[model samples]
Target: MVPTTITLHNTGNPLSPAANERGWLTNPANPRQASFHIVVDEREAIECIPLSENAWHAGDGSGSKSGNRTSIGVEICESGNYAKTLDNAVKLVAGMLKDRGWGVDRLRRHWDWSKKICPRLMYDDGKWTGWIDFKNRVNAELKGADNVKLDSEKVNVIVNGKKIKDGKLENGVTYVPLRAVGDALGATIGFDNKTKTATLDMKV
Candidate 1:
């Protein structure tokens, strides 16, 4: 499926954890045939269906224009630690959007597809306040991603057997603050604003 949007849903079963939700989908006797791409909770996110293929989510039927064909489905599990679940869901969804180069505007609720308050928690008793907050949180995550903070998540750097600071590993590439690393290596790093040029000087 060439997904154009993301469709959000809440499991609503506070008693059933993410693992349970995943198990339900996998169970042979569960009878219900609907599927979601990912199910996320506080501690884990599980992928039930591949994003390259469509799932029977959205309840909009198998038509070409239906969300089932045009969008990816993510079900947020609301078991224990509701806030944490929401937080994890935001990260998962934001990562997805970033992977697709999509903005927050591509997010849609189950209500948008089939007029069902499917992500029932976010419906906020029909006021949609919770939904707005949820999208805002996802938007914030996307903004942080744009700022490239994802680089800070891994690795330490060392040069000439000396440890370096501000070392980052993002998308399999290591990045360091040029000025800081240059100074550590007995060099000066300079930048010219007018020309947008960066210069490095080494004293041997």
Candidate 2:
């Protein structure tokens, strides 16, 4: 049966984990399975399974093409599963949203369009349901991630105990090595193996 017209307004709050698992995975191949887009299991070190393909997770709702062509899905396996997977799932989904310029509104649960709670989870309330949450999370993560420092920024030059040349600058970063600069300045530059420093002999 073609699934479509799954409502989200004024829906049932939720059920216990045990009950959730039963209804969530009840049919395994159930049409509503795709509703929860992100399925996370926190038992191990954090596993993320994506449902970018069609999942028979959506029940007989309005848009139940099994999400093959339309929706993106994520399934995570975890232990102590009291929304533990929420953080990671949000990250993964945020990455997807950012990369594809999608909004949290695009981050839908199976029940949003069909008659099931495949993911059986939500972020706070509808406030974090769509692309807004996805974008915000991605920006936060991008800001916190380790930045790539350019090697060029560390290069400076000294000759005859005096600073004469500056390293070649690119993109506001420097890359000119001491030897290169000294040689350009008509100085015989050599590497001192013992001192581990570049020695420049200039015609003073």
Candidate 3:
């Protein structure tokens, strides 16, 4: 099924009775924890492990297909009661969504598809249950174009931070010209002397 929500859990122990410290156990043969594609250690500099197969972290009889099969399930091995882990979890999830071209709408908690109350922290309240807000946050960072505005004046040639040589801005400001700026930005600028045309390009 196409997932429409992303869930974050604090895998750390909690003092509250509602928040159980012990999590699910996996099979030794195919071990569930190893299936998680990326695991971030808040104590370190974002250590990550990429897995080709699914991790059985969800729950027993939960069927790997529902969550791990198509989900980039992440387990944060830090103190969940603190906000640092939660923030890091957000970053990790955002990066995954950007890499896979899946929006925040694709993020999901283990409990959403099964019997376990995975992503334990998120289950405390319904504040973060929805997808729209989370997706918006991810889209803003991934695209990096939402709030950024191109300076169309002052001979503006940069589009997405890359200087377009000799290319005129939409406002008709071809101030620095393409060849000069392109050459400065390490891009190749060409001049068609015969046709009186100039071309500046950079490989994406």
Clashes of each: 0, 43, 9
Cα lDDT of candidate 3 equals 0.48
The residue-by-residue lDDT of candidate 1 on 1-204, one tens digit each, is: 999999999987889888899899879998997988999999999898888999998998999999999999999987897867887898999999999899989999999999999789877457664676677668878887335563356568777788766466777788665655675788755555346565667877
Model 3 CA lDDT for position 151: 61
Tens digits of per-residue lDDT, candidate 2, 40-150, equal 333322212233434343454335344433554444443354344445555665566566655544545555555454334333233223223333444556455322345
Question: 147, model 2: CA deviation in Å?
Answer: 11
Write the residue-wise lDDT of candidate 3 on 75-194 in tens digits: 665443334444455566777677667775676666666746656544424433222233444556777633324764344456557655333344553545343465466665554434
* C-alpha lDDT score of every prediction, in listed order: 0.82, 0.43, 0.48
> lDDT value for candidate 1?
0.82
| Displacement of the residue 59 alpha carbon in candidate 1, Å | 0.7
Could you tell me the TM-score of candidate 1? 0.70
- Residue 73 CA displacement from its true place in model 1, Å: 0.6
Q: Which candidate is the best by TM-score?
A: 1
